[model samples]
Target: MQPLVVLISTFTLIFVASYASLQPAETYWNSVLPNTPMPKTIQDRLMSGSVHDWGVSKIHPDICAFYIFFPLCIGSNIKAKDDPRRYIFLTESDLKLGTKKNLYLMKSSNNANFLPQKVDDLDASTSKNLTVAINLLLSHPTSAEAKDMRNTIDMCEAGEDNACATTLEAMLDFTTSRLGNNIDTLISEGDTEVKIQSYSISDLKIMKSKKSIVCHKLTYPYAVYKCHSMSDTRAYKVSMVNANGKKINVGVVCHIDTSRWSPKHLAFEVLNVKPGTIPVCHLVPGDSIAWVPNEL
Candidate 1:
């Protein structure tokens, strides 16, 4: 009887161990891993939820190589170097092109930097069509339609509402003529400039004063140091201090425009300065430079 009881216990243990071993292990998701290079399709679905789907799935392998892989290969990469803003922009560009999987990868990565607000800006129902357009723009940045779209953004930034509106109308007209349907207009007149109020950074209290913060002139997109308001610590306004104790006035901090394919700091071009004199300006606060809640 004792021998039989021992035999039964042994069998039960074996069965339980075997069943546990057969179960799948928890999947670990890493967004930066480089594997599974195939473009999105039905067959590629098998590679889903794998660690190897990171760098391999990017639309622009060349850009990804430069921005993501090269640094790691050479061992000169900055730790946690992924820029959420760039990723969001590039991902949106991909979604605009019809790369559904790329968008899904981004959404699934659960990166804090991913901008859901920007994604929500698109029409939810027409995701596939929007992705198609985005893909086209990504492949051919110099395309006439892409150029027009860029110009429209620029015009809107320059306060040319009529011109911007006309360009948007043209885009809608072109899409309607070609596809026999109109796309949800992502860019409109009212969505242009969003003003953020002044706020505190660390221990420093900022207040929006009489001075309007002006965007520094740069060859690429950069952040402008707008003054923060003291009262609420959330209000920000654009301003600039000039030489000869004169305050040079520029318009409100409307839009952040970038000409480069990557992130950079905002810089100023000093005019009317003495040959040996250097003008001084406040650098963007560390907290300010980092991601802030997109209330604006």
Candidate 2:
């Protein structure tokens, strides 16, 4: 009994020491946090949870990757007034054209980094606070404690830059908590080996349904995402063939519940509908991620 008690004490001390010593890599902030300040107009809209006129060019590799994987997503070049899919559209293109190789290049470069890193295994390129927060959130805080954490996250989302890291971590934790011990981060890459294991492009329409978090890459220095999950969300895995004949399996999340979404969301403007009137679906872009529960 004395030995067991000593072991427990040692473990607690080690955990506390490690937790207190955690720090982000010197370059983590430079790579993940935004360098140039976001335009006040765009920032204001984001704070209010409205993505209307995001203004950031989708041609940027990170943003462009979404179009490559989720070709159904309305392109930045398309005017909101011209979009025809104002409601839910589940159609998957068998042959995706017009996507550039630069989008693929960006995904290949950053795919590994987009994954959630463990607190003890983190490197200089990852956000330490975010890692720690996820670990804590997953540890089963009281309901009031969780609510307070979410409030802090809301403050962060409302432009409190100091709280952004914590906000992201908490969001990730909540998103992932939907699953048990079965989370997997999927990044689409066009490779022969992957193609062999992927679904035929035609089979995309019939794939089994699942739940997942479609994490969109937000404009940040290293890597930050607006990761969210909805009850009515359906994420599907489907194969897509690009113009170059490269095949890859990608995740597409369709949100059937937009009732709580801000009416001014970009989807509403692009789809020409008011919030909650109908479902909105989009692809899981190459630069982004789909966190799903792995099927046993």
Candidate 3:
């Protein structure tokens, strides 16, 4: 009996440990992937830098140092607001280009007495521009403009001007509105159409004296509540009621069906409205209704 007791205790500890370690999986199946929009300002900055040869300095001492250190300094400051998950670090190519531009400015200055002063000024300006470009690119890495820039860079490296020109023209059309009015068009072209799930609410009950009611105990994957209308289906909004019958705005999450007219009840998990309070069910005039237990 003592050995059996010890065995049961060991099993209980294992069960508890496993249950405690369990975590909910990411809800990726229902999540929407964000769309990338072209950043005009960043593209313009890149174009300006390329045309003026802003950072074209010697490879060994000037350009290499600037490229290696400057981006690390500036990249640390860049951040995204809406989705922090979207931020990306600078690529090796981007770093190389930035370094080359800075080195060019350092080498081309003629004022020997003011060389340090001039370099400092140039560094400040370049830092600001770098920050803006990096932030915008990271924020919209998959944008049409970014893609075009990538392709153009590739073509130039491969010594194929004709192919680059063709790609650039398509990019020009995207910028000039030939592609469509908004970024949504570009996103839609690449993404699957998202379908909205709808549900019907059939039976509802409000307890006049109780503060809380159980709506439905669901083991289903997902649920939504909607009301039946002859003209069109409408979603039912839940509202809280004060003792004086005045409605108070509150957010409620529950699932119910309203399509059928019957006395059968749907059970919901326990909801805390308020202790000793009554619930009032508000529906269309012809809606079927039933009472829900406080505990499911």
Better of 1 and 2 by lDDT: 2
Q: TM-score of model 3 relative to the true fold?
A: 0.15
Across 129-155, the per-residue lDDT of candidate 2 in tens digits comes to 433443333344344334433433343
What local lDDT score does residue 261 receive in model 1, on the 0 to 100 scale? 15
**How many clashing residue pairs are found in candidate 2?**
7
- The most accurate candidate by TM-score is 2
- Candidate 3 residue-wise lDDT, 100-151, digit = tens: 1100011211111101111222222212243343333334545543343333
**Candidate ranking (lDDT, best to worst):** 2, 1, 3
Alpha-carbon runs more than 4 Å astray in model 1 = 1-126, 140-233, 236-238, 243-296
Give me the runs in candidate 3 sitting further than 4 Å from their true place: 1-14, 18-20, 25-215, 218-232, 241-296
> Model 1, 120-155: lDDT tens per residue?
122222222433433332456455434433332332
lDDT of 1 at 101: 17
Better of 2 and 3 by lDDT: 2
Model 1 RMSD vs true structure: 25.1
Cα lDDT, model 3, residue 264: 22
Every candidate's lDDT: 0.21, 0.39, 0.20
